[model samples]
Target: MNMNMDWYRIFWHTAKLGNLTRAAQELHITQPSVSYAIKQLEAQLEVKLFDRLSKGVKLTSEGMEVFKYVEKSFTTLQSGEDRLQKLKELSAGELRIGASGPIIKHFVLPLLDTYHAEYPEVRIRLSQGKTSDIRERLKTGQIDVGIVHFPFADHELTVQHLANIQDCFVVGHAYQHLSQKPLTAHELSNLPLLLLSEGSSTRKYVDQWFSSQGIQADADMELSSMDMLIELAGRGYGAAFVTQSFVKQELAEGKLFQLHTKEPISPRAVGFAARRDSTLSIAATRFTELLQ
Candidate 1:
């Protein structure tokens, strides 16, 4: 049967109120229109939807089954509208973020602290992964935004430069003598170099740096964890290539010392990334704006 939505809406209202007059008042229509809609729906469905009563009407057995589906549909639609309203007012929604662990700890956490203080009602979700993995998540609509350390030039993502961070070779008090003099590429290569493993973007950046200087500082040890790298470097296991900002406490406490390089490693950027063509949700957009 060719059924109309208007007729079903009216039938839903009439069934809920159990009175044509009350349905008309709620739907902002006349009583005759409400009655006509009910008649049309009943005729189209080829079943009696309501039984006439002295004061009002009540649903028939068949009508009760129809009403069940209609009630669920309208309730879900109304819930969607309510959620949209809350989102528009910034009182409800979720913000999904993807980031590397170091970026989260050193950079994203402070911004999140302020964001939470301002929009405490908004739910925050965080996922940890490498830059490549986060980029894949964004492209697939798994996360809303990401903060990563990498080369900003890319076709796969819409990225914004967030902060300039300097990567350096750091050592501990056991190797403090290296800090006294600025070492050249050859000089730095001679020292035991602790490098992050091959898969990471940070390690790739460091690898390219070495390549640019016409050398490969052979890794005395290759590590995957920045924490362990820092810890071992602090104990003078070797000079670890890491971000300068991440070791401020160690530097100030004299546990680790920053190695000066003659061939300076240029500053790299921390980037905020999202899908190239995807539209971010209201909460995600607002949180991303803070980084701008």
Candidate 2:
């Protein structure tokens, strides 16, 4: 037999209130309309659902039995709706992120902490690598989004500018007594420098700047990890070329000092990158919104 959900809704409401007049008032219908719905449901079910009393009404045993099932069904339906609403509100889902070391430590990590506090059920997956590797993952659909340094060459990716990161030379406390006055790019060439590995974007920018000024200096050392560079610089190994944001705490704590250069290294554009053709997951979109 065909059954309407509205009929069940009416029946559920009447069962809860146990009075036709009260059920009608609660459902914003007239008493006759409420009675007619009950009659129709009873006719379809072939059962007596209610026993009329002087002041109110009560459910028959059969009505109570049917209602137990209805109550469970409707409860489950409400629960399903609540879960969907939470997903819409960004309380669930997963966000996959790709970022270089400095960006992850200095920026993305703090933002992720905030995101987690607000959306505990949303899972965040972070992959750390060089800027080039991160960009490659974004293109290949391995990562939903990336934090990269610019002059990126990808024409098919969308870039959203977040901040400008200033590059500087950091040194150990032993160099603290050195002149704070800015030195020309030529003078900077004289300092032994602990630099990031050759292919890194930071290294590329430094190389280009030196080339522009007609001064190519020999590196004191080359390291693959930013943490290693920072540690070596703190140990008075040599000056390390790094972003200002990455060493702010070290500079403040006197573990590292910034070496001023006359031709200030141009700031790199730091931002979010996503493939042009891909749709972002719900969690990724929410996190991106938070970044902005």
Candidate 3:
């Protein structure tokens, strides 16, 4: 049966007040409009909803049952509106981010700390993976933002250049003498190399650098973790290619020394990536703004 939902609303108020005139006053309508709406609702339901009295009205048995469901539905709708308002105000909700372990430790942590301080109610989720893994997470809507090495291109993702990072070869006491003189790319390539695994962005960048100088450098050891590479390099296992900013403490304390190269490595960009078509959550948007 065709029914006007407003009739149910009018029926609810009329039943609650037990008077047509009072329901009309509450709904800001005339008494006749309230009476007509209840009549229409009763007609559509094929049941008598109310019985007229000398001074007011009384709900029929069926009218009381319908009121129970209508009241619950309105309450649920009101609760949903309240939740949305909280999210929009940044007082609730979650922010998900993805990045490589080194990037998270050296770069993203500070920004996350600031965001958490300001919005303590918002939950933060972090996922550690390689740049390619981050890209996949972003496309699948698993993460709200991704911190990645620059020069990465994907039509499905939007990237914002955040900072510049310089990659350099470093050594420890065993190879400290190499730091005294600037060596050409070929000279540096002759030494044992400690490289990240093949598919990683840093590995790709380092390989391209050697290729440009007509050197096909080979790694004596390859590892997935930057921390492991740095630790091994500090023991003089080999020259570790790493981001300079990540080892400031080690470099300052003489635990590791930066190797000087005649061919200066150009600085590379680091950036924030997000799905091009997805709108960021309020917490995610605020976090990005904090970094900016």
Candidate 4:
């Protein structure tokens, strides 16, 4: 129990070489030191480790058994060190990310593309869920990083501001009149609206905004995916409240029109999250830098 690692290290080298003089040379120590270390090791382990021979030395039966474990342990230690070095250099590893559906579509996809191009060896795994779900994953070390919508608490996470997002009501060309002129809260209320389900942070934010303006917001249709909202809005199903960034394609192509509101929606942000106390993996840190 009083033995230290140096004795095992010396014994490992001495046993591997099977020559005390050669082991001493590899260890940059003298022959007596090698002899002394092997004696210390055999005494500590309570076994005869080597048999002296005319040429040099050879393992005893017990020595060979212990060498098997010692050899495997050294090999594993070396492999671990090599793996750690590779990770530090960003050469190999997987990056697990947590994101919501809309954020992935609008923001994370392009970032992933660029990250892959730069570090092709890094594997990216993405899990999509709501902001709260993503945060839970980040807290539990299930994911390396998360790009999520914010109005979130700063308790367990380190938040990095990524982009400002504007939410607005949009409709297809069938509702042309709603495009040019800003509508009052009461006027907006009268229109058939498509909204995300209550569990979503977007839904909560929009609901709070409407309540602050003294109007109770209700949706004629509720859907989970933002892409679905955009598509249905394009087909003139109803005015759907969506992040403007996600709909730049539909807006530019004249498929969807952004509605002007008398009470304009204030912009929010998409932020990235990592656990506050833990260090980010090299792959995750590289991806975050790419976003910056």
Each model's lDDT comes to 0.89, 0.87, 0.91, 0.88
| Candidate 3: tens digits of C-alpha lDDT, residues 1-292 | 7757789889888888999999999999999999899888888899998989999999888878888988887778789999999988878999999999889988999988888898888999999999999999999999999999988899999999999999899999999999999988898888889999998999999999999999999999999888888999999998999999999899999999999988889999999999999999988999889767
lDDT of 4: 0.88
Order candidates by lDDT, high to low.
3, 1, 4, 2
Every model's Cα RMSD, please?
A: 2.6, 5.6, 2.4, 1.9
lDDT of 3 at 10: 90
What stretches of model 1 exceed 4 Å from their correct place? Answer: 1-3, 82-94, 115-124
Residue 154, model 3: Cα distance from true site in angstroms: 1.8
The parts of candidate 4 lying over 4 Å away from their true place are none
Tens-digit lDDT track of model 1 for 175-277: 9999999988888888888988877888889888888989877889898778788999998898999989999898999999999998889998888988878
Compare candidates 2 and 3 on lDDT and give the better one: 3
lDDT of 2 by residue, 1-292 (tens): 9988878887898899888898889989899988898899999999999899998788999999999999999999999999878778887778899998878988899999999999989878899888889889998898998998888768778989998889888889777665478888787778888888888888999999989999987788998778888999899888888888888898888889888888868888988999999888888998899888
Evaluate model 1: give its TM-score.
Answer: 0.87
Query: Who is ahead in TM-score, 1 or 4?
Result: 4
Give every collision pair in model 1: none
TM-score of each: 0.87, 0.70, 0.89, 0.92
Mark the regions of model 3 whose C-alpha exceeds 4 Å error after superposition: 1-7, 19-40, 43-46, 54-56
